[model samples]
Target: MNLRNIQYPFLFEVPVLKHMAGFAGLLKRDPRGWPSDRPVVGMFLCLDPLIFCCQPQPRPFGVAHHLATRFPDETFVFLVPITMSLERRVNALALAAQHRRFQKTHPRASLIILANTRDEERLLRRLGVDVRYAPQNMFVDEGMYHPIPGRERRFDAIYNAQLAPFKRHELARTLPSCAYVTKMFTTWSPQLKRQHLGKFVCSLPYNHVILNDVTADDVVPMDHVKVNRAMASAHVGLCLSGLEGAMYASIEYLLAGLPVVSTRSRGGRDVFFHPDTTLIVDDDPRAVQDGVVAMKARALPPDYVRATTLRLIAEERAHFNVFIDGLRGRQVDRTDPRWSFEYAHKLARFGSISEFEALVRAR
Candidate 1:
């Protein structure tokens, strides 16, 4: 019997099958890495994107690096930095080495690089392998951001992003005449909060998305609701994040036909360059103000924005399918170690829930 070739129905075909498979594994715990008895074409190792504060970027492999250490069965596909900070480069190299070591241990494992910058792709190729550039995707729940006919007076503009120091500074300079709506409040130190107040006191009306300063992180129901509501009423959207990997907020704004005044960063570059997408700005305040003014003067068509966003989303799906199609290339050995519970956790964290669940059922 070809044990690895056992055909199983899709998870949706019979939802109860997962429970049945779980009961079978009740007595004996599955091994690490190669937990699935079923065949796996190849593994996709996710690379860390964020190198700031020793943290990885949010997209590509969001919050999945910590889980990589625990699962070594699958090959890795990384999203590398282009012209990153020194620390970031070092961290990327470290992750590369880690993935390389795994490939060495399991000859079937491989590395596929998807860099954030075009330059990074060249660097990877010089290192020997041709790495592809994977642009970030910003998806929003459409129902949340759709505009209503009569609620137009509630807000002037929506600027939803982080409350970092540089971001606060940019907003102060860029949005002099624009009222700003943010999901963050006085969560930062008193001095920082005061700094924000000092800059935009006259030019902007600062409506805190989440009211309480300290509890901003805990739960911001008010802020969340305000963001959705503002999207409906706002004439324009703004995102001035200094560092980003596909701004989800910008995606929401664009989907809502509220033109965006976005900072020119690597993360936002791909999305903004699309035809009549959003107004691009630099770190300078004056540039941001000009972009906002331009947006107020003219907003892109709703159909164009929607089509672009959907097209990008389709591109992502196509890439995923292509990646999965190449799985058969791995040279599998039944004796190799199987994936563990920790590996499942890693996959789930990285938005590979379906892939992980497939592994679990394969056992």
Candidate 2:
């Protein structure tokens, strides 16, 4: 299994700045029972029952093969697409190559991926990667985010994302009233204000980056309840990124009962989107503005939005349970069918990646 024989462009593996940024982020990690190259755990179904969530990045996917060896039976790998791009298949091929080295001895392949879109499933399967159609956003915590009855809708739209350049804040600049629920890395807000916020009334309306009333660090994420409240303060939510992983904020908007105005995106955010509840507009300021206006005019009920979103999420969860049960020749849990999914939603988020290895080792 010489990977050099199967040549594909490692497009993302190069570029000096990308590698530098990745290295900087790796340095901040707590590398305990794992090497820096080992991928972070995105989430797990149950540590006791052993459903490991594997992060499918180029270097990390190779390490998953190493893990499959040590905990052969215990190492039930479940990959969820982190991005809507060819890098996914490239990373998976890296894993398949490494895992093949031991296939003659181990006799069974353990890699499985939960696909975010039909194309993701088709592409991975074509490359011989085990894939399933289970969008990662479905695993979001519905309990933490929901519509608040009669909450004041002060703005026409809310765009809850980091104030990073890729977010393209300018796309939402033309909206007559839009609130920004953003996490400020540092000085990005000043630039945003200068470029995107001339007469925009709701420019930088809410910055809850600090929790527990702490105003010191804008890098910290706001509490989920407060995030929901911020979403509820507007009539619609905006998805502005063109390429990224499943946009979690999009689902949060639906859970908060706000219709969504999304630019044409590559990510799997559309998995949970209902046509009536979500409007896909061109990636332009005027188009986004008109989409927001159209959504506001439609005035879809908050209850209906929330209920439909939850139902769609449950269907994916059901798929996960059935897949696991078939493997075990029984339900994930005898008493609770969705027992594996009971792991706290926060575990699925990679903010606590450094702590994940310690937790898995402890189990």
Candidate 3:
């Protein structure tokens, strides 16, 4: 596939391009590269148009609009890496409506890629849309986040996530010998001062948490090499988020052969966080502390973690191939690994008991 044909929204931006290069490298290995023999499946990594609007040269949005207008019959897929919180669900519904209107005009295949969670799948299905789930955070590029041989695991633990309230960076503050890394995004304007101040105010008491700001403006580039190097140097990955679609940092740590100490992420994380690989705990601080201790005591084989990560990636690729094949009107097995819902209950189990009870009561 010629990546050139698919205009990347922030291609001119060096920082975003660096990150995109890593993802593109993985896509290059896929059997369905751009300019493929089969029907084209245009995949947008994000659905936020504001990101492109903020760019000085917003060609990516224009290209997307052109695709919808010119090639209405082409297959398109939009990926949502983040979970659909109540507020996000509202936005997603609007986007779904827009896509539905586009489909009405051209009548080609379209799908939304989300984490393997029954709530999200059922939500979209109820809205009359085609949806698919990857067993893990499928957007993680294996080429960018793999174990580096001979690299010593210097740090006992690493917390790699945004410094938002839901991430619970304070939980990591008490962990011994842990490195904290975060990416802060904000718009560039006079209000940027207030934004930084607000972050500072919110991070009080735990003031040691240093944030690496990667705002909409080119303040700091997301250096994957540096990020991956830090991840590889850590013995364990820590994710204390109250909720998530699939904590990308946790998966990154797993792919780097570091066992994870994570809270029960309410999304696709359960697909991989088995007894052998991760220490799952409640959101309580004491539980997190104990989980960390347990993770340290556990001797998880690096090879085992690496092998499991590769298998997950392979499975994701197989699922994508099936989606693509279906777009081509080819007969495909519905019972293939791609269609299995065995892991759906994993997410359901961790979901809110009150919510479940309400649903049961409603029925």
Output the number of the lDDT-best candidate: 2
What TM-score do all the candidates reach, one by one? Answer: 0.57, 0.71, 0.63
lDDT of 1 by residue, 13-124 (tens): 2344422432222233212343323222222332222111111333222223323333445444433322221112333444345435434554533445545545555555
Better of 1 and 2 by TM-score: 2
Root mean square deviation (Cα) for candidate 3? 15.2
Task: Output the lDDT of residue 117, model 3.
Answer: 65
> Which candidate, 2 or 3, has the higher TM-score?
2
Global fold similarity of model 3 (TM-score)? 0.63
Off by over 4 Å in 3: 1-64, 72-92, 108-115, 188-222, 330-363
Cα error, residue 261 of model 2, in Å, equals: 0.6
Q: For residues 131-178, what per-residue lDDT tens digits would candidate 2 score against the true structure?
A: 677787877778888889978998888888864556777787766677
Pull out the clashing pairs in model 2: none
Q: Give the winner by TM-score.
A: 2
Please give the CA lDDT of all the candidate structures.
Answer: 0.45, 0.64, 0.52
TM-score of model number 2: 0.71
Residue runs of model 2 more than 4 Å from their true location after superposition: 1-49, 55-59, 62-84, 87-109, 184-220, 332-341, 346-363
Residues 235-338 of candidate 3 have per-residue lDDT tens digits of 78888865455666777788778888887666566566657778888777677767777887886777788777667667666675565455434644455353
Q: Rank the candidates by lDDT, best first.
A: 2, 3, 1
Tell me, what's the RMSD of every candidate?
A: 16.2, 8.0, 15.2
